[model samples]
Target: MTTPAHVAIIMDGNGRWAKARGLPRLAGHRAGVEALRQSVKTASRLGIEWLTVYAFSSENWSRPPSEVSDLLGLLKLFIRRDLAELHRSGVRVRVIGERDDLQPDIRLLLEEAESLTAGNGALNLVIAFNYGGRDEIVRAMRKIAADVEAGRTSSASITPQTVSEALDTNGIPDPDLVIRTSGEMRLSNFLLWQAAYSELIFLPCLWPDFTPEQFEEALRQFSVRERRFGGRNERDVVSSSA
Candidate 1:
């Protein structure tokens, strides 16, 4: 099957998965981390060049303070424990989201991961932490306005590409396939602009239960999709006429 060049995941249902099993939500979060690792390995093995995962949203900060701390702690643990293995596996880690308000230690840890794995080329792993697609667009717009204010950019000359370049995912290509777990059919504030034409797959499995086989199944579904990118398929047109 033809593999997608880039795949983004809305890793949902961790808390629910844990609740269903009578385990703590933090346990679900930790299990999701293992699933994430499996996903990265699976994508790499399948020759997917880019994999983006929604780790945390800006709105997630509204959760209980203890829950927020637990999530942040899990992130720190993952970086510390798995970063070296990721580096050795040649994965380039990149984080997308606002960083100005992050705690100094967390901010430094994220930067270090990016800097350390920046040179790796095997597979690009993008973690969307403290991210919201609308917020990302707003931030990009602010950046563009800043440049225009300084006379370095012209408002009249701004194009979609100009706005895209201002985004945190500026150097990254738009995802070809977006897989959302736990049967969620919405983007839930994911890559709103970049995913204007992305093929979406909603799976029944929770994030914690996601496995290489599940990832492969998602890829299999994507392989047969007719991604015209806002255009009509010739075969479809012919079929309709017949």
Candidate 2:
């Protein structure tokens, strides 16, 4: 099977998973964290170079205060508890999102994770916390605007590559395959700009229940598809008729 160089996942259905089990939402979130740990291992073993997961979104703040608090607590716990193991496993941690207003402690922990794993190269683990795809594009635009205003570069000279470099994911390659669990069929404001041509796989299993087998299956699904971007290939002509 063809293994993608990069894979991104929208981990969804935690609350629904908890509801199905008659457990609290936090319980589901906790299980989701374990799923994440296992996913990291699976990705490494599969030789996937980059794995980006949608952990928390900017819009998630609209959730109930108690739930939000619980999520934040879980983030802290996960980082403090898992950072050592992640670093030792040769996973380079990268966090992308708006962090200017985050709690000082939370910000520090995120920075520490990136710094500690900066030298690791086995896998790239990107956590999209407090992230929104539109927000990321807006931020990139703002940076470009600022540069233009400062006479750093003419507006006409700015290209797609320039905008991409200004975004939080600068230097990171776009995902080759994007997966979403819990049967969701939308991107849900995740990696909007970067995933323009990524192959998508929507899984029926919820985030907490996602397994290595499912991950491997998604790769299997990706391997047979032909990606021609906007252009047409001979395969497309035959496949379209079939």
Candidate 3:
């Protein structure tokens, strides 16, 4: 089977997971973190090279202050608790988003984690915190514009590849498969350009309830897809069968 080189996930329905169990939302987020840990282990064992998760979106700031604070605390806790083990396991952790919006300590921790795991080569795990697809695109555009103004690049030379290189995921391959849990069909402004042709899988299970089996099932389905990438139909199957 052709294993995907990169996989991205939009973990959804945490609040609903808590509501169904008569628990606080924070409890669900905690469970989600546990799920994330399991996912990392599973992905590594499956030989997937890159995994990117949408942990928090820029629009999440509209949430109640208390909830936002709890989320930030959880992020810090995850970094502190998992960074060393991840480094040891050959998992390089990276955070992609606007850093200025984060607390000073959290920003420092993010930088430290990135620096510590920079040498690892097993699995590249990226967390999208305080991230938005539109924002990322805008940031990339600004960068390209700056380069053009500095005479480093000309407007006539601008291309899709040029814009992609300016984005936060410059070195990473585009996700081959993107999974969103809780049966959500919308992309929610996640990885807009990067996921342009990615195969999407929507699972009914909530984020916390998602298991390794479900993840495997998604891969199984992904394996059956005909990824033509807008190419015309070909008779390769018939020719090979002959």
Cα error, candidate 2, residue 24 (Å)? 0.5
Report the backbone clash tally of model 2: 0
Please, what is the whole-model Cα lDDT of each candidate in the order they appear? 0.95, 0.96, 0.93
List, residue by residue over 93-176, the lDDT tens digit for candidate 1. Answer: 999999999999999999999999999999999999999999999999999999999999899999999999999999999999
Please write out the lDDT profile of model 3 over residues 23-84, one tens digit for every residue: 99999999999999999999999999999999999999999998898898898999999988
State the weakest 10-residue window (summed lDDT) of model 3: 231-240
Per-residue lDDT of model 2, residues 1-242, tens digit only: 99999999999999999999999999999999999999999999999999999999999999999999999999999999999999999999999999998999989999999999999999999999999999999999999999999999999999999989999999999999999999989999999999999999999999999999999999999999888888999977899999
Winner on TM-score (2 vs 3): 2
Q: Candidate 2: give the clashing pairs.
A: none
| TM-score against truth, every candidate | 0.97, 0.97, 0.96
| Alpha carbon lDDT at 16, candidate 1 | 94
Model 2, TM vs. native: 0.97
Most accurate candidate by lDDT: 2
Better model by lDDT: candidate 1 vs candidate 3 = 1
TM-score of model 1 (CA atoms): 0.97
Q: In model 1, where is the ten-residue run with the lowest total lDDT?
A: 223-232
